[model samples]
Target: MGDENTPLGAPQLAREAKDLVELANTEETVSELLRRGLDWLTRIARFDLATLFLLREARLVAVAARGPLANARVRGHVLDLAAFPMVRQALETRRARAFTEEDHSGEGDPFDGVLDLPPGHSCMVVPLCSGERCYGVLTLDRSECETYPQTVVDLVEVYGQLLATALQNAEQRSDFERLHRQDHEHAKLLESQLGGDSEGVLETSLSPAMRDLARRARQVAETDTPVLLLGETGTGKERLARAIHRWSSRADHPFVTINCAAIPAGLLESELFGHVKGAFTGATKDRAGRFQMAHGGTLLLDEVGELPVELQAKLLRALQEKTFEPVGSDRTVRADVRILAATHVDLQQAIAQRRFREDLYYRLSVFPLRLPPLRERLEDLPQLCAFLLDEQARRTGRRGMRVLPEALARLGAYDWPGNLRELANVLERATILSRGPELGPQALDLPTHVRAPEAPAEKLAEDKPGKVPTLAAVQREHILRVLALTKGRIYGPGGAAQLLGLKPSTLQSRMKKLGIARQELFIIEGPT
Candidate 1:
């Protein structure tokens, strides 16, 4: 930026910046840039392992793996964003910082054990964050005993920012590519249903639950009636809604989604039914509501159960009559959208409690699709993990990952009350933290509360110190205890599986394998 022995002036600096920006914006593929970027960081940082975890869906995904990590191709291999204190701080505030081993060791931090590196080396992870979200992190673990200096931190932040942008851009490019490739294939199918005859759905799931959902979605796609999707939190309801749209007559139109719980009640009404210019404070321009934007396509009302009661009647009117006035406008706008709504809550209970409109409920439930929780679909965990890990590897072109069978076994037994979304997060967390060839239970930051109970008091007193039961034994005892407590039910509340950290169906299979019966242990299933 400067002449020999002299400082550069403003114009020269500006020109240099423009040149750098151009270099960054070149048509080189994102994978190439990411590879080169990691190479550069490894040299500059002198670390043993390095990787970048880009956000996908709602979880962090390892797009690039470098340095000393063995076998990087395992699916959903990632870290929990909300669980990492350093990442949480950096991303939420949009500030760059690093964490060392000394900062760990808190009573209830989500980031425990993440910084434990090979040898005597510590770890450093700089967040690749933008706005309120963290796209990924530039992680480095070094064998040297020296603490990181300010210069290294600054360099890591810059590299992390560029890497995150490259990752985000690559994902968008992939989406465009997928849409292009699938659009033609789905033409006949889209036309049959949405009048456009689209047939295929996004390959969002490798799990049987997802495949089944897609199959059932095809049946609902051809109908003109409203559809309601019911599931626990973290289930991919919006993704399902979009799949429905892609196969419907409205395939050529927009698909819009708005979370009822993410917005305030007063402003949500105006957001859904646009306010006139200057209708109230800050209404400076004419705007089209989500409905208008999604006209002729699908309007996904996410978290629909959270809509305020006052607006429930209004929503019902619009659903039935297909017309609505703006918040401050008297003109009635005709709606041509196929309404698709989703909620994690039980709407029947909401209606009974007078928190929802029964008429609206009837209309939406005309075509109902219930997304089974992750626990119900434990049979699909292995496939889903493989798909997600491979997708991440394919995106960033890493070495790929390896998942041990035992790890998968433990994973399938998890309760997954948070559902697929949670399962995805757990896998994502494991991807970033795990090294070498196999993913083990220690790397999986499952809720600490999920650990096994102490031995029964009688057994503990009888045993020698430091001896622990095998995982299977622990699981068996836990199930037996739950069976005694519940009296009997295998699939309902207080069921053996729920009492333990497992799906009911898994418990049943285990019980059958172990030749144990809830009926023999107890006499009742809880009230439904």
Candidate 2:
């Protein structure tokens, strides 16, 4: 090969340029591509060392290197723009420039400590740039003091441009892949929230009242209007809200739920609107809140009436303008989210007490929907029981379990003060207690007050032979009964643990061992 100063003929240079273009267009990761590019540069430019530095947040990081100077220590070396004047100049001017030891006379060499370059070596910095954007710089150094011919410099410049374009394409592709994965994960999460295939229960409601309510819900689902779901604690407001989301045009997107009463008053704002890093004592990193998570989809503010008065104004603004600032962040974020608010609290009474804002109530209740309590639709009991029992069986891997007519009659006799949630709890307990496929009235374990009087307690007790119950079974049944009586409260006075004469933590441990989920006791509601 000729010396470094000997310029290549036009024809040979053209062939070299074609090969470099093909190398730049190869489908590889950014790091791999940069490494291969550096190898090509060292070979073609007759340089002993080469380094590829990518720009990240105003700092240049050495991503790939080759030759004698390339070592593990040199890779990932970060350079400040102020220190690497020639690199900065090349990036700013979008040109290739050569520097020697003479250029650093009185001024210390930028690469002195980092590269430890020998005296009289020539270093050329080429800007990896396309259009007006400079992705980074490519630096090559030779062992000898030699100038790069005009032809070699031109070829290197062309290589830099092609490499920059490839880097941009790779970054864009990576972003697209990340977004696609996020969308798929969100879809799965929403599917779980809606309780996959549970939305169909509303369509097949046995009760005429429920059927009519489903019809109105479907009508409202077609619109983007705010819907306020009104009902008692266990009347299936959340189920109805999810049905509305599934029925709406935004069903394909996220269906995020945030229980206002579930989070503390101090953290509720951050939960709704999100927060930046260092926003609060426990907030170590940025978090996207319910609103941001539900972007381009639906956001259900469950138990919305429990929201504090101070945050109501901010919530009202978000609803009215679809814009809100994150906690500790002045930048406003706008989300295209459909609002669905659910509450058992009477907004009228709350407004009178000044506990709820009248303006927020008006904005939320644009199309209010009141869910009927389970007692109002006892005719649907049999179908509802079948669906819930089948679902529980599928979940627990215990199949072919059926409820007896006597048990159904007993269930209907009781006025469900806790509504659908109470009924679900009763069924789950009965499922656990029943040893056979059939769940009889005895299996129900209903509180004495709600037992059907027509069944004549003495006669019903005589009908079935009693067997000694397992210690675990007895304990589970007794805990379930107390929890039902306490309406799922575990701590404080009148709670299940207090009635059972056990500490809250001890009761919780027993509950976990018995496979009794707190959600089943408190929040499990039928699809109606």
Candidate 3:
């Protein structure tokens, strides 16, 4: 080191100040900024060691340190305000103070008791403060016996103030980011609740079966009677339930839904009826349940078959009386909620097996509505594909997306065991795989096992030698002739569907089932 008596040149001091200011303005986490700040001070000031402490809960915790022994153990060191008098005084005075070896009394240096510094060491304490707020104290130690010059003390004081301001800004930024994330999550939740497909399953459904179902659902929607929705998995029972809620008088009120199979048997009761604080192990506060949340609206209990037997009785009571007691609370709460329950389980079988209450089943199935499987309503594929593709395009920012007719035919050929939900997933995948605006057959990755198998030639050739064409063959030949007459047109007036006096969607379903391809229809020369 240079002579303690010699002053730092103005140019050198200006450069040193610039470095400290640049380090303080660095966009980094609070802990990282503090660590780098300490490193710069120790290296520039030529000090043997330096420690930065932050005030937390009336105590100074060593947050960052630089030296041979400045490991995790030293950085984690804590000093109570009452225990470290020099550090407390530095923070209270908002000033920098220097101490030499002669300043210590016989009791020994305060830092020596904690940091285990060598005897005859000099140190300086600078308060990391700005305005009226004091963040903490910065302590710099030197192994030499020389006192710190006034210039070095003043430089450290400026660094401390800059670091303190940076720490405050970093914390504020962290809080702002956290709040923004929470607001984004809340917005998504609200969107899911209110901005879902308004028309629901009825939007593009061309199947007469679905139209009839919608007509019946509208009749029952005006009434508060429990509507039991029965369908296979992925058959859009929840979508239909939402449609019914939208059509009902309570449309303005909240529409709440809960999956009975998703929650555990023990906690599902609390999820349905809510619980008071101290109701269970993790119940730190009171919460509204699905029933209370859907008051004056509709409550959909999805996968109702999975509800535990013990909770079914309480549910039945709530349905019958329009009142329920929350878990761990004796006070009765009443809710005017129109209940809709949906499940794929056969309740009659469940009753036979004594797994479900017969009374509860009758109570829930007051106005039962069954959703037709996709295979049974294959005519809806074209419209459904168009709607789904448009939805996916809008979501993924791919505009004017369309599916080729052959690709749609390929989709129709699959016996979708997972129904509409699976169709949506397949279309979404196709949209992602397609490079152009048009989705072709190559974009579809349908499972080979699920594809509708073609009839063996031997089965069709049975018409030769004491064999007659099967009904399927005759139907296929007739549909092919009709398609040829309409020039492969399946929809609209004067199309093959109209020529055959069949609903367009129904004709498509029959054609798919009969394994009739559009190319074969066009190639047919005045029938086979």
For candidate 1, lDDT tens digit of each residue in 1-528? 112223344565444434434444663576665666666564346666676666565466776767664234522266666665665566666545655545554422222244344333456667776434566666665566655666666656665665566556555676777897687457534433332111232343434566677788887898877889988887667767877887788877767789999999889988898878978888898888988887878899999999999998888888888899988889999988889999989999999999998887897899888887776655456556665565556544544675655466567556777776777677777878987546777778887556455778998679875576677777675555445434455565435465466787887888887767655543323343
What are the clashing pairs of model 3? 379-505
* Ranked candidates, highest TM-score first: 2, 3, 1
Using TM-score as the measure, the top candidate is 2
TM-scores of the candidates in the order shown: 0.48, 0.56, 0.53
lDDT of 3 by residue, 1-528 (tens): 334455456676566666655654565567877877776665346676788888897898888889765667667778777766766778888989887666665334655545677766778888988767888888878777777888778766776776777667666677887998787577546644543563555744555689889989988999999999999999889888888887889876777899999998998999999999999999999998999999999999999998899999999999999999999899999999999999999989999998899999999999999999988777677777776776665577778878776676567667799898899899888878888888888999899986445779997666466466788887786565455444577788656776667898999889889888766654532234
Q: In order, what lDDT does every prediction score?
A: 0.67, 0.79, 0.79
Q: Looking at candidate 3, what is the lDDT of residue 210? A: 90
Ten contiguous residues minimizing lDDT sum, candidate 3: 519-528
Question: Across residues 232-341, which tens digit of lDDT does each residue of candidate 2 receive?
Answer: 88988888888888889997888899999999999999999999999989899999989999999999999999999999999999998999999999999999999999
Clashes in each model (backbone N, CA, C under 3 Å)?
Answer: 30, 0, 1
Off by over 4 Å in 2: 1-186, 189-196, 450-528
Sorting all predicted structures by lDDT, with the top scorer first, yields: 2, 3, 1
* Per-residue lDDT value at 159 in model 2: 66
